[model samples]
Target: MDGDCKTAVVTGGTGEIGFAIAHKLLCNKGKKVVLIGNDTKKGSEVVDSLNCSFGRSKATFYKCDITNREEVEGTMKKAKNDLDEIDIVVNAAGVWNDVCWPNEMETNLGGTINVVLSARNHIKKGNGVVINLTGLSALEPFPNSPLFASFGAGVIHFTRSFGHDVNFRRFGVRVVALCLGITKTNLHVDLDKKMLTKEMGKGMSDFLKNACYQKPDACACAVAELVKYGPPGSVWVVEGSRLFYYDVPDYKECLNLVSQFM
Candidate 1:
């Protein structure tokens, strides 16, 4: 690894979007990456593929379950020890099952909290970045999968709060949220089964019939760009292969609207 190369830790690295992000970082941005996931076999295979394409030591895989704080902290420590320092941490591991909403919440929101807290310690101050992957559902109501949307909204709020200017000045870490829209991944498969009810599932299935889907590579590209230029507390949306910044109004700004009604 080159001393000047940036090192990143990507959770859920074996998945489509996560793998694409890792690939973009290594191949396009010339960065070293540590992939974290629970599937030992898939993790090793992804690392192998990345290493073969990039370099022998450009990529590494650590078997970790992000929902476990202890495991996440331990893995971050090991990754820091191996890489010397972590520059970027991408919280990409999430679940969308409404039937098992508790587990989904634990993995999506709890896992993100664990990784962000652990990474903050390992990441070098004054030059660290954390990208939390939310979903488009966070921006709007998803009647089909309310729990999934709720989890995304929670993550967005957390990212915004943690990435505020006050926290950034204190910790020197920039946190940003990326809201991805209907991407072509396994996440879309069996969408009905993942919903809160069969009726909602059917509705969701019908809703997506004409929806446009972007490839994972498009999202990966947006992530790479954000890693380089996104400001702390910023939110971005990627849909139909296009990326755009989203301005989240402050409490005062929202209160102004209520005052008009009064």
Candidate 2:
């Protein structure tokens, strides 16, 4: 591995899933991680913990809002200046909002765009990987979380499209989406309880209640594997402990699949 391969920038690094991924990167990949998040207190705590586990100066924190493009760009520049070129970028800053769809879209989809655009140039010259954290809702929408599903679907499509961006390809950067299924993360803390409960109904609620949720660490392990194995324009899905390449067929293929019914 190259000397520069040990540096990474992770958005939403204060969150449970993001922090887990950072931990995996540090322990398994031997990467120095710079965490970006809005919560200064939590970010500091996470960085301190990571540094303690890894080594002093191996982990750092940069407080920034991913929804703000300027803040994201500035953070990226500072990270690059401080840690040299970034080998990997993990976009884990997202929200599942049903009360306010527009805000949710801005945070989840727009924030992803801001991070990708800002970090595209600074990614390592070759073999740099960008992992956008999406959800199974992207492929299979849930009733109560329409906005969240929409954001994930948008992110999956955009990740593929952006993988073909001239600058991204020129830098040999690979962009892909990681579709996680029912991970135990803090994504639903701000959910509208009444709206979610009512929208989900009894069956959905029961299903969710009985469903087996993958732990943050388990999901993080799958994400780490995808970071190394996922090709440009691809999407990888993980359910429980099973991970597989997700194939999103084109419209023509869909039409063909339905031709018999027509």
Candidate 3:
């Protein structure tokens, strides 16, 4: 990725998907990565592994609560000072908790906002890119996971708007929303037993059984490719191992029609 990008920050870099993305950036793209996550132990483990693979200083870990704006800012500053410039920022930190409504929403949506806003301030000019991970739930709601769907949908809309923002466009940073297909991740490990045993988890369980889950490593590669070449403000979907760009129509005509009534 010479002249394209150099340094990247992957939020939730301790998670499976995030880790894979970090690895792709470090090993494949040959870019330095600063990982942000709340888990010190897992974060340390991932950092150590990446460093071992790509030599020391290739990866650094920061334990941060993305929902906290101050912490996000501090982490971003430290990363910039440590890595010089941030060319890519991937908001992969998310939650699928049905039990904790507030925390889930805060993590998935609020945390994403914190990262995107802080990242825009630090990203390099003209070639910086921000990739926000959304999911199928965002495009189509699941009856059982209303909160999760809402969070995903919120992120998609926010990302699209950020991509369309005039000032943001001036920065020349590409913003993309990635609709990752169902993948095996730790998010499901502690799912409420009661919910799983009852109707709530049925939909999810069926979805998991039927959904064509992509491997984290493979999806990581696709994400790297998207970061390298995807158009700004576009949404890309990955399902059943298929990766493709999603078209968003120009809504000017609809807006014009509505403005007459207003």
Candidate 4:
């Protein structure tokens, strides 16, 4: 790798959206990447494919369960030591299984906290960026999967709080959230089975049938654009293959809106 080459660490890099982001970062942006995931076999296969496509040593994989704080710290340390420095960290690992709500919360919310806290110290300050991937349920209520939506909302709040301007000024790292719309990925497969109840599952399935779905590549493209220009503490929505900034109202704004009705 060149002395000036940027490097990234992407959790859940073996998954569709995550892998797409890593590929975009490497092929288009000329960045080396370390893929973090739990499946060692899948991780190795992804690393091998990326290295073959980009170049030898351009990609590496570290087996890690992001929910495990100690494991995450160790993995981040190893990734930093190997890369010399990490310029970007993308928290793309998440679960949507409401049937296993505890595990879902642990993987989605807890895992994000672990990864960001562990990796922030080694990230290249001043220019480093952290992209936390949530879903549209964060912004809009999902009647079918309230548990999953709650996790998304929690992630969005966490991202905004951590990525606030005051914190950015002190740490010099830009943190942003990307709320993706319905995308064709494994997360969507057998959605009815992952729901909390049969009625909710059927309703969700019906709702999705009429909703617009985009490819994972579109989400990847959005991530690339955000990585380059997204501001700290900002939230972006990527839906129907379009990317746009999402305005999350502050407490004062909400208060004013409520006062209008009174």
User: What does candidate 2's lDDT look like per residue over 11-32, in tens digits?
Assistant: 8899999999899888774558
Return the candidate ranking by lDDT, descending: 4, 1, 3, 2
| Candidate 4 residue-wise lDDT, 1-262, digit = tens | 1213689999999999999999988867555899999899999999999999998999999999898999999999999998898988999998889999999999999999998887678899999999999889998888999999999999999999999999899899989999999999988889888899999999888988898989999988888888888899899999999999998876786664435554
Candidate 3 per-residue lDDT, tens place, 124-190, comes to 8788889999777898867878888888999999988888657556778888899888877877664
Per-model TM against the reference: 0.94, 0.90, 0.90, 0.94
* lDDT of the structure predicted as candidate 1: 0.89
- Model 1: weakest 10-residue lDDT segment is 253-262
The best-first sequence of candidates by TM-score reads: 4, 1, 3, 2
lDDT per residue as tens, model 1, 47-132 = 99999998898889999988899999999999998889898888888777899999999999999999999988899798788999
Which one is best on lDDT? Answer: 4
TM-score of 2: 0.90
Query: Per-residue error at 136 for model 1, in Å?
Result: 0.6
Summed backbone clashes in each candidate are: 0, 0, 0, 0
Clashing residue pairs, backbone N/CA/C < 3 A, model 2: none
Each candidate: what lDDT? 0.89, 0.81, 0.83, 0.89
RMSD to true structure for each model, in Å: 2.5, 3.1, 3.0, 2.7
Task: Score residue 109 of candidate 2 by CA lDDT.
Answer: 94
lDDT of 1 at 156: 91
Q: Lowest-scoring 10 consecutive residues by lDDT in candidate 3?
A: 189-198
